[model samples]
Target: MSWMTLSLTLIFVFIPLLLSKTLNLGLERDTIVAALRSTVQLIAVGFVLKFVFDSEHAVFIMLMVLLMIVAAVQNARHKGKAIKGITWKLFVTFVVIEVLTQTVLLGLHIVPATAQYIISLSGMVIGNSMVLAILFINRFTAEVETHRDESELILSLGGTPKQSINRQLMKSIQASMIPTIESQKTIGLVQLPGMMSGQIIAGADPVQAVQFQLLVVFLLLSTAAMTSVLLGFLSYRSLFTERMQLMKIDVE
Candidate 1:
C-alpha cells in the first residue's frame, strides 16, 4: 500500500474522532492518541520484523518472542494490580500458553520453522493470552469484591480459601472465556479473520487461507482456556491472607 492508500485509512480514524466530539464522550484525545500510536507502532514493528525475518537466527527469534511476552504481561498486569504479585502470575501463564501453542504448531509440522511464521503466530498467542489474562483478572477481582461477605462467611465456617472462592473462581473463568467461545461459533460465517483476509488480499488461494485461519482459531480456543484456568488458579490464592481469610483490595 502506498502513502495515498494509507492516508485513505485515516478516514476511519476521523469517524471515531467525530463521533467522540459530537457525543461529548471526552474521548477525542484518546482516539487520536490511539490512532497515532498504532500507526507508529505498526510501522516500527514492520521494520524490526523485516530485519528479524531476514536474519532467521534462532536466538533473535527467541529474544523477540520474549520481548512480546514481557510486553503482554505488563499490559495484562494493569487490570490485575489489585492482586499482589500479579505480574509474575501473568508472566507464567503467558509463557506457558506461548510454549504449549508453539510446541504443538511445530511438532505437528503445521507451520515451518521460519521467522515470519513463528513471529506472526507467536503474536497471536501472546495477544490472545494477554487479553484473556486481563479479562480473568478484572472479572475475578470484581467477583471477589462483590461476594466478599459470602467468602468471609465461608471462611468463618471453617472452609479453606480455595473452597471459599471456588464458585467465584469458576464463574470468573467462565466469564473471561465467553468472548472467545462465542466469537469462534460465528467466525467463518460472520467474519473473515485478519490472517485469512490478508492472505486472500495478497492473492493466495481461498482454500489455503481458510486452512490457516482455522489453525489460528483452534490455537485461540486453546489459548483462551489455558490462560483463564492457569491464571485463575495461580492468582486466586493471593486474594486471601495467610490465615485463609478474605483479603479485600480497593475496587476502582
Candidate 2:
C-alpha cells in the first residue's frame, strides 16, 4: 500500500473525530465547522495553486497578493473595529512587510526568482501575519478597554495620545510575537512542524527540508514581528483624534 494513499485515507478518516474532540474543549461548533471549511478551502486552493504556479503572469501574481491583503485587512478590521481604521493599518503594514521580505529574499538570492516561490513567500508572510494581527488587535482592543482609565489619565495629564498609548501598543506587539518566537524555539525538539514534516513525508531530503523549514521560520518571524509592531503603531494612532486627544478606544 502506498504511503500517500494511506496518509490521505487517514486524513479523511481521522480529522472529523479529531475535530469532535477539539469541539469538546468548549469551542462548540467551531472546530467541526472550521475543519469542514478548511477541507473545502484547501481542495479549492490546490487547484488555484496549480494555475498560479503554471503561469508567470505578473497580473495573476498581483491578484493573489491582493487577495491575501484583503484577507489580512478584513481580519484586522474584525479584530479592531473599536478604534477604527484597523484595516488600513494592516494594509499598510503588509504592503511594507510583504514587499520588503519578498524583495530582500530575491535580492539576496535566497529564493528562486520564480512565480510559485514568490507567491508562496508572500503568502507565508501575509498569512502568518494575519495570525499576529488577530492576536494583537484583539488584545490591544481588550487592553484598551481594560485600562481605559489609565489611558484617559495619561491624556488628561498632558500626555500626547502617542505617549499615552505607547506602552499598550508595545505590549500588544510583544504578545503577538511570543507564539512565533516560542514555536521556533520548540520546532525540532517539541514537534515536527508542518512544513518540514510534509516535505520529508513527500520524499524530500530530510536535511534539506529541515534547512528550508528553518529559513521559512526565520522569514515568518521577521515578517510577523515587523508587521505586528508596525500595525500596532499605526492602529494606536487611529485610537486618537487630530488634536492628540485619546478617542474612545472601545472596540466597535
Candidate 3:
C-alpha cells in the first residue's frame, strides 16, 4: 500500500474518536494516543526488523530474541509484583517459552532458523506467553486473596503449603488458559487470524496461508498452556511463608 492509502486508514481511527466524542464516553484521548503510539512503534519496529532480517547473523538474531524476552517480562511483571521475585519469575518464564518453542520448531525443521522466521515466530510465542502470564498472575493473586482464610485454615490443620494453594493455583491456570482454548475452537469460523489474512492480502495462496496460520495456532496452544502452568507453579510458592503459612498479597 502507498503512503496515501496508509494515511487514509486514519478514517478507521477517526470513527472511534467520533463515537467517543459524540457520546462523551471520554475515550477520545486514549484512542488518539493509542493510534499514535501504534503508528510510531510499528514503523520503528519495521525498520529494526528489516535490518535484522537482512543481517541474518546468529548474534543479531539472538539479540532480537533477548530483547523480546526482556520486554515481555517487564510488561508482565507489574501485575505480579505482589509475588516475591516476580521479575525473575517472569524473565525465566519468557525465556523458557522462547527456548522451548524455538527448540521444537528449529529442531523439527518446521521453520527455518533464519532471523525472519525465528523473530516472527518468537514474537508471537513470547507475546502470547506474556499475556497468559499476566492473566494467570492476576487471577492467581485474586484467588489467593479471596481464599486466604481457607488456605491458612488448611495450613493450620497440618496441610502442606502446596496442598493449601493447589486449588487456587489450578483455578488460576485453568482460567488463564480458557481464552486461548476457546479462541482456537472457533478460529476459522469466527474470524480469520491476522497473520493468515495478511498473507492472503499479500497475494499468497490461501492454502499456504492457512497452513502457516495453523502452525501458529498450535504453537500458541502450547504457549498458553506452558505459560500459565510454569508461571503459576513458580509464583504460588512465593505466596507462602517459610513456615508454611499463607502470606498476604498486596495486589495493586
- Candidate 3 residue-wise lDDT at 65: 94
For all candidates in order, the CA lDDT equals 0.91, 0.80, 0.92
Q: What range of 10 consecutive residues in model 3 has the weakest lDDT sum?
A: 243-252
State the lDDT of candidate 3 residue by residue for 183-240, as single tens digits: 9999999989999999999999999999999999999999999999999888888987
By lDDT rank, best first, the candidates go: 3, 1, 2
What TM-score should be assigned to candidate 1? 0.94
Q: For residues 34-92, write the lDDT of model 1, one tens digit per residue.
A: 99999999999999999999999999999999999999987878788899899898889
Q: Which numbered prediction scores highest in lDDT against the true structure?
A: 3
lDDT of 3 at 12: 98
Clashes per candidate (backbone, < 3 Å):
0, 2, 0
Model 1 clash pairs?
none
Give candidate 2 regions above 4 Å deviation.
Answer: 1-36
Q: What tens digits encode model 2's per-residue C-alpha lDDT throughout 118-207? A: 887788889898888888888888777778788889888998877787778778888889999998888899999787898888999999
Q: Which residue pairs in candidate 2 collide?
A: 82-251, 82-252
RMSD of 3: 1.1
Tell me the TM-score of each prediction against the true structure: 0.94, 0.86, 0.97
Top model by TM-score, which number? 3
